[model samples]
Target: MKKLLIIGFLSLFFAPLAQAQLGIKGGLNVAELTGREGESSSYKAFYHVGVFYQANIIGPLSIQPEVQYSLQGGNLKSAYTNYDSQLHYLTVPILAKLTVGPVFIEAGPQFGVLLNANQSGNLQVGFTEDGQPAYGNESRPATSNFKRGDFSVVGGVGLKLASNFSLGGRLVAGLNDINDAKNLTGINDPRLQNRVFQVYAAFQFGDGRR
Candidate 1:
């Protein structure tokens, strides 16, 4: 994990050495941790802002790498009946970029290390079908336990205006399961995972060149 972190940083640092340019990027993330079917999950909105460096490795093709502190994952539902989880991570993505005229397309992999997590909503059970209060046992204890080092795939597209500023959207989907337990009381419940979609504006710092 440490090695992967090092590599991601290095990729960002060296990308500028080869016809690379720096940029500031920020986005809106519609994030959620997906659970089993019929579990009823909802996603929340989070924000992310970070800087990136893009290196043109070949004609119309480049390696763009970035390091960003991202706010990801949460639920938006009744506090007493829903689970809400938020995670902060420094993410590094190595992307392959393509440009045609002013439109740019990018796809890549990202590695993230969890910096913090918080429990903002309460968990309850036996709520009525309409989410009304009801008398029943709390389904499970409130849990905040999760793991660090999440790996995922990120891909997006952008439009470059004046070759210096861009507007784009991206989606981040986690590859590893976020659940730390093999089974909750040996119930065989499947693990949950992360997924996020982002839309934002970006500014390139240098003239477009290879």
Candidate 2:
């Protein structure tokens, strides 16, 4: 089913070079991992970049399919230490877009395949609270516990600045757990999921009206 969807999108992507608009986009990601054992998840900053194709189905309505490479993760701050984990994925989103003048809104399902993941931060091995050795602090690379693929839903709004340029923002919420318990990282939550807020600018080729 996933393969068929990708293939269909690709056909839409290449149907007519003159009729459809192609765009390149890059963005900032504010990511957080939810469903923790006890610790509160903090936001981590990352980035994403990709290409997309837009095809109009009717007035003020369109379909867009995008392929993006994204960096996502979360931060953990505790009484003894702090940790930062980064996960990288290749993602695709197929969106139904609606426009009103210069403003447009979009909603869609996104799919991702994990590329890589890692963590690095300061950790307390032992602590000294009362003039005695209680906790030790050291910097090291933490273990990674990540799944191979991720499923998510995305929604956003954008405003067209001109015929060729636009500014946009979106939220992506993971529907599946991106953590693997088999590769247990004692520092990370077992049921890790992705939550990201993205801000982006898009540059489109050819003159396409919104």
Candidate 3:
């Protein structure tokens, strides 16, 4: 937790260095599992509030590094089971950005440090206290002991409008495992490593820098 605070502090301190740009972004995200099979297909809304720094290396090429607090996960349901798990990650991505006229594209890898994770749901089995068909077991929220992942891919596209404000979308695909539990069901795959997609609008400061 201390390291997360340090990263967050550095993100703010790097704003005024050189031609660094600061912006606010908010968007919807679609999250799901990848790599292995048998995992359920699900989508969830993920949003992040953060800042970014852009340093131009060439005419139309720049490197933008960002730090964000993101929420990502999915809802799963089986024949007799229903549950939902969400992951809150402090993600950092270093992207290579390209621009042409008003359109721009970026792609890079991201590292996600898990902040908090929880599972909540109610199991439906037989009947309720009233004898009618109802939820079997009451929902009990459980915290997760999740470890941080190494690397992931971060890429997206956007358009610059009037030089100061821009609109874009990006996706973060996790490559490292997030689960550290001992499996008894023979499922060795990690559950915290999921996919996140974001669409946001940015307002760049320091005019004539776009």
Better of 1 and 3 by lDDT: 1
Model 3: residues with Cα > 4 Å off, grouped in runs: 1-17, 35-39, 123-145, 183-192
What TM-score fits each model? Answer: 0.76, 0.80, 0.76
Scored by lDDT, the top model is 2
Q: Model 3, range 1-210, lDDT digits (tens) per residue?
A: 999999989966665465656665656777764443434557866677777877776678888888888887767665555666677778888999999999999999888787777766754435666765455545443334456564789889999987788899987788777666433344464455677788888777776376
Question: What lDDT does candidate 1 reach at residue 60?
Answer: 91
lDDT of each: 0.76, 0.83, 0.72
Worst 10 residues of 2 by lDDT: 133-142
Clashing pairs in 2: 126-134, 126-135, 126-136, 127-134, 127-135, 128-135
Off by over 4 Å in 2: 1-18, 123-144, 182-189
TM-score of 2: 0.80
lDDT of 2 by residue, 128-205 (tens): 555442433444433346788899999999999998999999999999988774421245446878999999999989
lDDT of 1 by residue, 120-188 (tens): 544433347776655332323223455677889998998987767889899899998766643323454
- Error in Å for residue 76 of model 1: 7.1
